[model samples]
Target: MLLEKLRAEVLEANLELVRRGLVLYTFGNASGVDREQGLVVIKPSGVDYDDLRPEHMVVTDLNGKIVEGNLNPSSDLDTHTLLYREFPAIGAVVHTHSEYATSWAQAGLDIPALGTTHADYFYGPIPCTEPLTDEAIGGRYVHETGVAIVKRFAGIDPMAVPACLVAGHAPFVWGKTPDDAAHNAVVLEAVARMAIRTVQLNSLAGVSQSLLDRHYFRKHGANATYGQKS
Candidate 1:
């Protein structure tokens, strides 16, 4: 079985999105990349979450060419591929239309770090990309979506933030693995919800930079000490 392990991981990550309520119907996709093999395993396009299987995961190369599986790859395969190609450190990518996160995307607003909950996962505000031009949308849209994300993170480190809202669209997240990517998707939604309520209660209030840095660093990177040692 070619890419058997990667296929299983990708399938589980996709199902995790559904199980966590980050996706409804087929509104999300998760992909795991095998950088050594130059292939990615992703959910099949439009497949029901309950009906998905390990073998149903489609394998494609960095150029988005199907390498295995009978069904078409996720409609966002190019988005995943472009990220993997551009950001070599990321091992997985997840795209979701989760309610709160998508709401922020559609509103064209960033999710500010309003509390410790937001700072624990995201280093600062979750940025929303600028709206895509008609010409870019008309061209290779999925590829353009990836380009938009890359453009938005001009000076931002993807590892520290790990997620972004696509203006007028949805949220895209990534991490060291498929499971990690899915986890970030869940966290993004939760923070987005809290940010909405936080603003409603006090529009001028936000997390102080001192607190944001303390919480973010304590849970992320080599200096992190929030959880048990590996």
Candidate 2:
């Protein structure tokens, strides 16, 4: 029952993925961090979505030490841990092999911000990390996946974008909370689907920087005007 609230939120976020069709047969996982406690709660590896409950969430420290969980953490624990360490601002992380996002990753291309929907969530095209080198893949790969993502964001703001497609793999997304990360994952898949169809109709069509700026800033930044003010 440790971190009962966090365990519940993480559980709900995982269920949200299934509800949104963002994951299949437990193919994805989500985690939330209690920043003050420096601990994480994540789904157990290989557990079916239908069978998951709050206590099923495994708790681990920032370094991946088990603090309260009886089951093993998700297979991607290292990646989530590394991200938490490297990107201090994020409170949650979500990984999903969602159809369209994974398609973009498989194709080794960025999902261009060709319209406003994408701009609303991401400040720019969703970047795809360079494919993992054979050596990196062979050595500490789960952790190396995070290394590649961190490397890709050298000059970019993780909050501004909030998601990255792992080349030839899937998308990893994070946000200020578990719910927010789940929201981004859902948005990323929607935009990815739209981007695919757009290229099919006209490969040259693209969103202008000015339009991208207008849409993005309306929902973000100090001057954000989207929705009512908090």
Candidate 3:
């Protein structure tokens, strides 16, 4: 148990995705990084949720090398690791083919900040990455997935948005901890579902920058006041 607590947190986050209906069958995975020890604990690849336990969580180094565990790490380990390396502020990552978000991704559309519900979590539009080039796809598809995501956030603060929807794929969400990542995943799905309906009602619908800034900053900005003081 190299990362005993991180293993349990990763397990719980994976289970949370299933419970929240963000993942289907064995289609998605969740992982947590212990920044200090430079280790990651992730859900075992393709394993059924019902069969998972803390021990089944695999431990790997930052480069995706297995340090402990009998099972293979999630296939998206490289993407998770890249995010950990690039976005040092994040503590955990969760990837899911959540229906609404995936729909936007498949359409190669950004989920717009159509209302406060979306602005409350995502500061602006939830971005969709540019599709991977054929060369990147052929060479190292999984690792390149992370490259596209990082490219999309070139000038943005990853902490401000905390999520990215990969073009023609699905969404990857992260936060300060495994539970926080899971929570953000659930919110991402909710807003995405709402965005679809909002668009149908009015294609011109969108929140103004002033309102977007107000809602986003109220909760996530330096002087956040949405919830009671921590």
For every model shown, what is its TM-score relative to the native structure?
Answer: 0.98, 0.98, 0.98
Q: What's the lDDT for residue 120 in model 3?
A: 83
Give the lDDT ranking, best first: 2, 3, 1
TM-score of predicted structure 2: 0.98
Give Cα-based local distance difference scores for all models: 0.92, 0.95, 0.94
- Write the residue-wise lDDT of candidate 3 on 48-137 in tens digits: 999999999999999999999999989999999999999999999999999999999999998888988888888888899998889988
**Cα deviation of 150, candidate 3, in Å:** 0.2
Better of 1 and 2 by TM-score: 2
Root-mean-square deviation of candidate 1 = 0.9
63 in model 1: Cα distance from truth in Å? 0.9
Instruction: Name the best candidate (by lDDT).
Output: 2
**Model 2, residue pairs in steric clash:** none
lDDT of 1 by residue, 150-212 (tens): 999889989888998999999999999999999999999999988898899899989899999
Error of 3 at 181 (Å): 0.6
Angstrom error of the Cα, residue 199, model 3: value is 0.7
Point out the higher-scoring one by lDDT: 2 or 3: 2
Question: In the order shown, what is each candidate's alpha-carbon RMSD?
Answer: 0.9, 0.8, 0.9
